[model samples]
Target: MIDRKKIALLICERLLMEQEMLRVNYINTRDSIGFFYIDNLLPVAIATAIAESFPTSSEMKLKKSLKEDKYISAQMDKHSEILEEVLYAFQDPQVVNLIAEICELQDIYPDEKLYAGGLSLMEKNQFLSPHLDNSHDKERQRWRVLNLLYYVTPEWKIEYGGNLEVWPNGLKAPQVTIESKFNRLAVMATHNDSLHSVSKVLVDKNRCCVSNYYFSDEPLKSSDTFHVTSFRGWPQEKIKDLVLRTDNFLRQTLRKFFKKGIVENPHYYKKE
Candidate 1:
């Protein structure tokens, strides 16, 4: 297991020290893709331990689609004690409050149910297509305002692919590559235009990440509107792009009528 209190304390101190710069960075990007990151967010030892705690890919659920190809799980009870602790450390009230302050967001809350916020593993050829996350929480009550992705796979490199790509200027323009570097904590604002995706993994090794989302009573931007998770293929894959766009359209249309949808999303952490 891990010491949640100790971890939260460490985070509070570091974020407090960088609060000004972090806020500035986020504000600067608020008009665009809207994101900021911190390298070596936790001690090297803590980061390494978290990575080591990752379960084998086979132990997780595979989600293969035109939108994404990866393994993810919220069934924390089946995982390590260290993982559950580390995952929720970011959920600690003080830590959550500090993050909301840094991002200049108000009335925010952490998702204990961890909807699409848990462990993700991607291997060679897997990728997440450019997309906007589902705007609201499971019940369509809270808006998902921010995404916290902590990459723990040691020695992951940009050249190795599986990097985070942001289309701030849209797909016609080049993407800004944010390496899925080891021990890096990336926080991105999520709304209608926060279009992003994970580049395809090139090497045979797995890219591991601990993910979370913070919800708010309000959308990140005044102009932000509601939408289902929308996806588009990478710029060059025209046929795939057409297919995905159509697919996203159909799903989104369905969501318009069925607010919660006919079938509930089984991706959430189902507490026993």
Candidate 2:
């Protein structure tokens, strides 16, 4: 059995070793959407174990819509113990604090409930449209400050297309593609302008990832405002963009009246 404590220790070590480089990368990109990535985040053997242990897509909950087509689950108990262990490893204090230090962020806290954070798998034809993450936690308390994505799909290629896309300059400009390489961990700032998405999977194999988010008592920027997870179509998809814009507006308006949306978002973990 993989111990989360041991895994977290390894994560902390890696982050410490790469702290300087990570800080520089983040500083370079801080003007647009601050972000950085580290390769070989865990030992190859452990990463492979996690990849092999991922549940089949059919076993996870399918979320298919205009915004995305993927499998996600926060019900950690329903999956392999290692999967749960690895997910929470990012939440470990040492690991979280190291990441916060590298990003120059303060007052950051990990989400224990795993709200909108857990395992995600995308198969061929599956994709997530460009969007900004929800501004706050489920309860409207802490500001969602950072997104942590740890990719474990061994040998996953750039050509296979399940990569993380960041529209730093918005949809009008060319976007940057970060390969979903195995054993690689990518962290990005989440703010009103930090629009990002996942490229559609072109291969038939599953592209799996473990995800987590760190929240802070204050927003990343003083001017940032609260908003729901907003989605938009590609630059060329004019009609779809219009429809999604309307959808975003409606959802934002709904949140104005209801603290939580009409129907609860069933994406978070429910401890039993």
Candidate 3:
């Protein structure tokens, strides 16, 4: 019972209101980035319940650069019922219709497979280095067009970092940071140039989120080349970026041979 219909409607209404708040002059990039403060974004009880469904021991080990909370996807086939609810929210006909109408999206289809879209939680000192998401979907059949992130952490504070940072500029420059507030949804265009990441959480708090990516039959940019999700260290962390670049290069090369890369990232939740 995710109450997807109600949630979708609420989301639509919030977006309509916030649509006016989108400052074209302030957009961090040449492309688009919109944020909506959706009141009652999701049922608090349901979110807490869903978050508790998985045991602490079941949480996935995060990428090693920093401390993190957990990573869980809706249980693969087994949690289809719960998964469907989340997907329905992401694929709500009205949500899709509004996005298509507003963004002028060209051919928005319901993606049945969630890919790397799922839940992420980060705790104190946890940091996700600056990075660019993979330019294409797993099969490379669809262009990764949009990134939808819904934050659910209750009473999250500014000092307790874990904000989403988008670097429309190349990795060499400063980035634009968007705080991940509770009951808020962030939607942004995803192209090869869409560089983004999560800032480190300063305090001992958990930052949890729900994520989804929408893909199109065509590439987001005609000139967009195929690239892996590239990561960079802080501007001062030059050595870290060098190491990460090598890591990205190897992974990208492997992707050329293995369509899904060395091992399929088990980002989606799976049931026992």
Candidate 4:
């Protein structure tokens, strides 16, 4: 069984080797939805082990609504131990600090509770509509600074449709698609304007990702303000867009009156 320390070591070594190039890519995209991805992030054997250990769709919790459709699980103990090991490896101090330096960010911290973080799987026809992630952590204490997604499904293709879509120029403009390639780790800066989504899955296979988010004492951008995870439909879906907009507005409004909202979100780990 791979442990967090070993996984973190492999990840740090890979990031250090590609540090310069990743820095450049991130800087160039900083004006938009700044991000970078590293391929072959781990040894093929280790990557394969992690990928193969993923829990089936039924073993995870399904999140289905107008905003998104996917299977997610933050309850690490309920699934394969490798999944939890890989997930927390990204949270290791050395790994987190190294990633922050590459992105030229400071004061960033990893989420231990895995709020909206953990394992995610998308099956046929499932999708996450374009939206900004909720700006803060569970307690609304820290600003969600970066989104770290490590795709592990072997040979997942671009045409399969479960790719990461960045609407850097806004929803009406042509969005950038980041393939959910195997053994690739994608890190993206998240702020008020960092709008992104997952394209619908078109094939029968599952697209699996080990996800984590880093938070900070301050916002990524000076102008960023508190907001809910706002969702919007594709440009052509006028009615859906309107409905989603209204939904976003209502949720945002509720947050103002109730700092944490009416109910507690059940997506975080409940360690015993």
Over 52-117, each residue of candidate 3 has an lDDT whose tens digit, in order, gives 443242444465543123445544344434435655687788887676555556687555566777
Worst 10 residues of 4 by lDDT: 232-241
What does the lDDT come to for candidate 4?
0.95
- Name the regions of candidate 3 deviating beyond 4 angstroms: 20-29, 32-61, 65-70, 76-87, 269-272
Task: Using lDDT, give the best candidate's number.
Answer: 4
Q: Please provide, for model 1 over 58-132, each residue's C-alpha lDDT reduced to its tens digit, 9 standing for 90 to 100.
A: 899999987899999999999988888888999999988988988888888999999988999999999999999
Model 4 RMSD in Å is: 0.7
What would the TM-score be for candidate 4 when compared with the true structure? 0.99
232, model 3: CA deviation in Å?
Answer: 1.4
Q: lDDT ranking from best to worst?
A: 4, 2, 1, 3
* Candidate 1 wrong stretches, greater than 4 Å: none
Q: Please, what are the lDDT tens digits per residue for candidate 2 over residues 122-179? A: 9999999999999999898999999999999888899999999999999999999999
Model 2, total clashes: 0
TM-score of 3: 0.82
